[model samples]
Target: MTRDHPADFEEIARRFSHLWQALNEGSPGTRKILVDRVRDALDRGEARLRDADCDIVANSFVLEALINDGAATRVYRARHRDLGTFHAIKMPRPDHADDPVLRKLMLREAEIGMGLRHSHIAATQTVLRLSDGRPALVTEWIGSRLAELLQQRPLSLGEITSVMTSVLSGLEAIHAAGFVHCDLSPLNLLADGDLSRLKIADFGIALKRGSRHSQFDLAFAGQPDFASPEQLAGEPLDERSDLYAAGLLLSLLLSRCHEESDGTKTLKALTNHLSQQDVQDRPENARAALHLLGGSPKRPVDA
Candidate 1:
């Protein structure tokens, strides 16, 4: 005899079913009202299911903000809703999304980034697939970039040692894995919130040492300030080339940032030598640079 909002669709269904049964005892008018209510209840149930499915925005990450827009990729600050933690999601720029080349590069970077699981190296959490079928690389979210910070202030000699050691540590692991970070620069080097640790980012152009590559691979994806002489010359790259970049970074780190530069000609010479136009004259590898920093005489690969 009366109609009202039901507790929920399930409750509505249960009540309507009983109403239908009662329809057999009622007039035709009452039976018609019960039929309409049944249709409404079914519609609500279908809508609820669609809403539940809509909750999953992307397969893995839900974007929270656009943290950076680089030349090739746009990085988003996202969260893994399942884990309730923050991460950085790197996706192809909007215009570049449809480009097959960019897609291949993104997959390549994801492959390499996922392989590295070192402390000083930012860890790639997982690969995410967008609704458009594009792949995105998700890494642990970091809040600071070393390049930006250094421009504002300098580091103490002790602080320089800490940063260099950590960077070298990551480089060692990378080189030992047979991969050379073709683009190692202050811009891509990230430090944790407290500036206590460093994490290397951006491997889109990294190449395996001694691996075959493009003729223009040297200038393809590197920052000029940090690009090694061999890298700039289109010569084959190895761990030593990355060492050259590391040496340049090490030089920048030791600039007036330290409270005192009592006696640092040796460090200066090491950095200068690393950027030499001739690759063979640079430190043999990351280990050699570390050794030089530790007061050992520089015996570059002059041999």
Candidate 2:
């Protein structure tokens, strides 16, 4: 009789047989040693699997460098093989690739993003499924994260207004589309050099307007610092919830700037209004917030 064996078949069989024998008739010390050996072998196998999964690549794009190593996903700067254009490719971390909740979040982000077309919103190009069944999101490449930029220097009044104007405009579009950007923080905003362009990115935890908290868990939703009072309480969310986050974002930007100016005082008051503990105390929606910011309502631009 002939038999086929895998590369590690002999090693695996030896370990298993030794464990079985120890369990049945070996001394206590022998059993303990065999059990430890089995555990070590299992750990090695899992390590190999994790290493293989970490080397993910797509057929259409070449990953140039890792851009962001986030809690749930890893973003890479990649170039499309045929188009030769750069794009931001986001994929779930190796540990999260097979998690159903994370996969659902990625799909939800794609769906919400595909419908939103605006200059101030990072556009989702497409979702690519890897051979290993992991979904990767392709989005427009922006220069830098707002968090990174803020770390370098404080913005001038003009720069602050420009960034806030762009962000509120983007929020208006997102709210109009009937979705709340549940997660809005400095890390989620992308900006270009010269402050000419800023776009909202990452809709991974966006909630539909008026959606009940029961639909999704808020514990893992928005950032605690930027989250509205109602969001932390697990209450239903609306456009006001997003406005609250926008208010918090404005406050953060203001903190980075020089203080005690007349314009800074005015913005501080607005921030207080937007981030009021009571949901009803905040602006009704993004449009209303923009009105408070002394900006005209601009029509949404196509991506």
Candidate 3:
């Protein structure tokens, strides 16, 4: 089937204005007043787009097939009429499209993803408005989550090393861009054929390093089982928070190492890494975890 291409930002803005006008029609006097105020806000949004010199390439393509469903969004495999071929689109539930805070957070996630360019990071293709006026993000289509493969066949130490290295490299690139992926877990990690060839996905909880909004108390982002202690304690965090998560991930790998071996020390590392209440207590970052996996320190802890 031939897909419809996304309109340019200017055209999209014009359509948005027209839609706002239509919504304001036939409203009660006070309701009309509020609608008019909202219309003004839409105008400001258009101006911001103009000032930003929006890219038409950044428009999301509509997917022809549904991929999966999650708590707040649905995934689809879409063909980009403009870009050509397929990409994945994530859209919020139909009922929550008008939620201001949720929408803003989704946009932020898209923006951050788009800015990131890393071999192990899933690239964001576009952030566009759906036919029903809901916001959605288009991203490179990943075949499966890392967790799925790990569940099927446990990863060898050498195999886990490859995955860890790439994961850390991707994260380092993100840190260099001055962003923190507040949400890091197996569910958010995707892989192609093997664990070594993995890509980091899902940025709904990511934040700019120093933005005021970055300081909001997000007790735990994403899966609770993989959440760090500081995340559980509702404390503000930075790169170290990510490190703690990487440590937990390492423990998961260690647990899967031997079918009969219990991962007690690995769990101890995770606990102490957070109990110290210091990011430093956590390995410096993904690279540090990789170093530990390589037997750098030569500790007598159970592997």
Candidate 4:
């Protein structure tokens, strides 16, 4: 019976089964073992998908196909048997679906996404358990990413402000909901119809307001060069971290060239305000940055 099916798929299933065992064991060593096994599984799976003439994500709402394969798991855009629409299906690398850590990450992202309700934030539709016993967080598909837009050309001032407004609005909602978006970067930001509309994506590494911050600095995860000192030092963060990221977004917006000459000055001002390397330095948060941008719409008086 198995011979009728592909040998590669069979091998992948066997490896996945082994990985499941290792993850269920729930030890650091077991996790490491599972990680390697999952990598092999993904490679095989990708080949099978290609052979089947399938895209990374399934086109039909009824079929399940791999959409996003993140560091820890593979997600499929699938139609639920009951719900009858396309939704995100998350599982812990086929092998580690039951792993507590992976399970927690999935739930955490879903909760954060649901809590943050804004046009600029990816909306969480629902979270449910799959028939195969894996967890899924269904969300509105925001389509392609900001990276695609910026690839063509840099955004204009008005365009950037419009996008930032949405992003900041979303951040405000996120902060109000009592969570910190530990990950914020161009890749995580998505564009809808045009550059003016932006949506922040990927909440996997987010931290709740009162939770103890991670020891390893995640600031580097977003963009180390753009990170504020507090993030670089792994200190407890507030709205200031988001401001630092916004400043980078601001720099990208205002700079005439991709690498603006005045970028250093702007970053310096923002870093001083945020990092407080000097005791006398005044702290400027995202709100303050927005205030600065507020005046951008007005033309400077001829002097």
Over 4 Å off, model 3: 1-62, 81-84, 210-220, 259-278, 287-303
Tens-digit lDDT string for candidate 4 (88-136) = 5555665676677668777878887877777778878777675456676
User: Per-residue lDDT of 33-151 in model 1, one digit per residue for the tens?
Assistant: 87656655665565577833222336445678888888767888887755788888888776676888778878888888888888889888788786667677888988788888787
Ranked by lDDT, top first: 2, 1, 3, 4
- How far out, in Å, is residue 183 in model 3? 1.5
Candidate 3 backbone clash number: 1
The digit string of per-residue lDDT tens for model 3 on 151-191 reads: 88765545655666667777878777877786777878887
Winner on TM-score (2 vs 4): 2
Clashing pairs in 4: 56-66
Q: Give the Å shift of residue 214 in candidate 1.
A: 1.9
Clashing pairs in 3: 63-78
Cα error, residue 270 of model 1, in Å, equals 2.5
- In model 3, the worst 10-residue window by lDDT is 51-60
Task: Tell me which of candidates 1 and 4 scores higher on lDDT.
Answer: 1
Winner by lDDT: 2
Worst 10 residues of 1 by lDDT: 294-303
Where is model 2 poorest over a 10-residue stretch in terms of lDDT?
294-303
Residue 98 Cα positional deviation in candidate 4, in Å, after optimal superposition? 3.1
TM-score of 3: 0.67
